[model samples]
Target: MDPEPRSAKGRRTRARLVEAGKTVFERDGFLQARITDIATEANVSHGSFYHYFDSKESLFREIAEEVEVRLVSMDDIAQDLTESAGPVDRIRAANKAYLAAYRKEAKIMRVIEEVSRYDDEVRKVRSKRDDYLAARLESAIKRLQADGLADQRIDERYAATALGGMVAKFAEMMFIGGARFDMNTAVEQLTYLWANALGLVPTADQKVPAKSATA
Candidate 1:
């Protein structure tokens, strides 16, 4: 169900609550952060918090939802793919897109990933987000097939999972380990990995490259 309409000011007030709650949870974790802290952060009463969210868990779920929703968009991805100079560029765009989203909201992503390790409720939300990302990758793969832009040798679904798994695992590692990973390295390594796996041969026009097939 949609969130009930409040006056614009009231809606803004509730939004602040959700946003603040998300920040706190990302900083302190799902179990550690309290609704009272969120209430104070939002400049709302603890009573007013109930008016917006049923519980802290529900607010955390919403934060996870917001982060996952930004991960992939097949529609935008299609444009990036076609406009790319070659398959290598397309692969880079795909990786860059994934990593960019990951880096943009790594905090909330970490919260969702970390809490999900122990909580069934959080697991459900994380599963939903994974499903959504998988669906988008599947769609993007289907579009590539239809356009004759991608090779038919590989199963697009399988390729999507393989590719998605690589980044997903990397992000999970970043959440777990103290690492100096950055977006550029993710874009470069993931693109190289995907391209080499796909047996893609890129020409000079492609901004970066994987080495020759027989080399």
Candidate 2:
């Protein structure tokens, strides 16, 4: 059956709710946020919240999915890395993007981390994210090595897997552990390892620089 005309409005309302929910989740966190708060923030009837989402946790899953999407879309970072810069620069830019996203959304991100502890659904979301990111890193690593920017000495698969793990750990420490993880430190650390691992230019001590972007 053709859907009601209100279906479009429903979709719009749902999108607005998700967007508002993201801000609220980012502000107060998913564990702490309430349906009333989201409804109030969305300026919708409290009952309407349920009409759109089964529960607050389901709403959070929607938000988490969007966040995952935003992370992967990152046109500026991916383009600057892939289209504008060489393979080594691509790695550095990608690292900076991960850290920047983590820093900007630390609270909502903490919610994801916390929820993953006991919730299988949240864990699945996280697992999917990790797998997608790992595949991307693996492909990029292979591409770089094949293109001669990376060192053939290192196993392409191993380097990609190791690099992906390092980036994930770096985000955790930097955003969650409150470490002194700045762009410079990220670049210096990754660039050094990447250059050596890939047998690229700049030898030792040369760090890859990324063009600055707004947070």
Candidate 3:
């Protein structure tokens, strides 16, 4: 059944709540965040918060939904792929887009990661997102193999899992392990790794330059 329609003001208030929820969750994290904190952050009353959300968990799920959608929006991915010239280019584009989104939503992602240890519902949400990204990478790997652009001996699914885990963990380490991450360098190296793992040749544009004799 279709859900009941909310008035314009109701929609605006819910948006404010969501924005405030993200801020509160990012600052305080899931374990430390409270309904009152989100309500205060939104400048809305406690009753209003309850009216829109049954509990903090529901609100967080909503935020997670938004984050996942942004992270792997097929429309955005298609645009990125469309502009790419080859497998290496496509991989680089995907990495750049994922990294950009991860940087922006790092805090919330950390919250989700931490809370998922004991929260089954949250863990499921996280797992679903991971699965979606992995599947996309797996498909890309298969395509490369089909075109004779990648190593036929590589197991597409396992390779996809490894690549996805490496990128996700790298981003996490940068945020929580105090690693100094240079975005451009990280993306370049990651692209190189992906290309090498698939046994694909780098494009001429990606080739390393030889030192000049004068030097």
For residue 174, model 3's alpha carbon misses the true position, in angstroms, by: 1.5
lDDT tens readout by residue for model 2, 1-215: 11122677887778778877887887787678888889889989888887788888888887787776666555668555435466556666777777777777777787778778988888888878877887877787678767767667777667767777787777777777777655666766776676666677873444455644422
lDDT of each: 0.73, 0.73, 0.82
Error of 3 at 214 (Å): 28
Give the per-residue lDDT of model 3 (tens digit) for 10-72: 778888888999999999988789999899989999888877888899889878878877877
Stretches of candidate 3 exceeding 4 Å from the true structure:
1-5, 74-84, 209-215
Residue-by-residue lDDT tens digits, candidate 1, 57-98: 887877777777777652355666654366677767777776
lDDT of 2: 0.73
Candidate 2, run of 10 with poorest lDDT: 206-215
Instruction: Identify the runs in model 2 with alpha carbons over 4 angstroms from their true place.
Output: 1-6, 78-84, 203-215
With candidate 2 superimposed using the best TM-score fit, by how many Å does residue 130's alpha carbon deviate from the native?
Answer: 1.2
Question: Which candidate leads in TM-score?
Answer: 3
For all candidates, the clash counts are 0, 2, 0
